[model samples]
Target: MLPLSDASVLVRRGDVPSTVLDDDLVMLDPLTGQYFSLNPVAAALWARLERPVPVGTLIAGLLEAYDGDPAIIAGETRAALTRLVDLGLLLVQPEQAE
Candidate 1:
């Protein structure tokens, strides 16, 4: 699993295509011709991932928008991100020098 620091940036690969239907997100990986279905929370995350997003920012946004224990929300968010990365659906960029 990728060790995602708070500053790690996540970006969706440009070639992947996805659509939302009845609260679920269906994504196709063109290269592998594999399809992935994501739940409502992940669909929402996908929308926010249109642009590069920092992990910390993602967690904070989820906390503000959803009702859940902070720790659980953060843990789930991280796990979801790791799965997306492992599946080659998302890319993780190391913290940029500033």
Candidate 2:
């Protein structure tokens, strides 16, 4: 598993199928026939993964949009990203040539 960091860039897998129901989002992994559910907050985070974005940027955006504690928000965001990566629903972008 890739270690998530502030600079780690992440993007959702376009091939995976997903749908929003009510205030949550559900995704299906056809290979394993496993389905995953995301709460409103996680769903919001998923929406942002349409394009690659730095983990720090995601945390910053969440902090600005929510009234939660800074540390809690950052920690939860990182945890969520980690889970997504482990599930193969998200991808870590390889560093490009500088």
Candidate 3:
């Protein structure tokens, strides 16, 4: 498991298959035959994973788009990202060299 940090980059695991509904997203791990669904917020996050992104960038974007307590938003986003990682729907990698 990777530690959740502002510097770490997150990306969707390329092998997982995903579907998008009106405001929801579902991912299926064909190998494991496990399906996971994301709420609207998580769906938005998932949509952002078309390419790798830094954790801090994700939080900053959310903060700019939504009205909420910064700390609460950070904690919930972190937790959501962690769960996505654990579920094999997402992967964490070292920040890319650019």
Provide the clashing-pair count of each candidate structure: 0, 0, 0
Once fitted onto the true fold, the runs of candidate 2 whose alpha carbons sit more than 4 angstroms away are none
Score each candidate by Cα lDDT. 0.91, 0.91, 0.87
TM-score of 3: 0.88
Instruction: Score every model by TM-score.
Output: 0.94, 0.93, 0.88
Report the Cα RMSD per candidate: 1.0, 1.2, 1.9
- Give the per-residue lDDT digits (tens) of candidate 2, residues 1-98: 75687888999998889999887798998778899999999999999999999899999999999997899999999999999999888999986656
Residue-wise C-alpha lDDT for candidate 3, range 1-98, written one tens digit per residue: 75698988999888887888777788889879988888888888888887999999999999998899999999999999998888878888866677
Q: 92, model 3: CA deviation in Å?
A: 1.2
Ranking by TM-score: 1, 2, 3
RMSD of model 1, in Å? Answer: 1.0
Candidate 2: the clashing residue pairs are none
Superposed by TM-score, candidate 1 places the C-alpha of residue 45 at a distance from the truth, in angstroms, of 0.7
Report the number of backbone clashes for model 1.
0
Judging by lDDT, tell me the better candidate of 2 and 3.
2
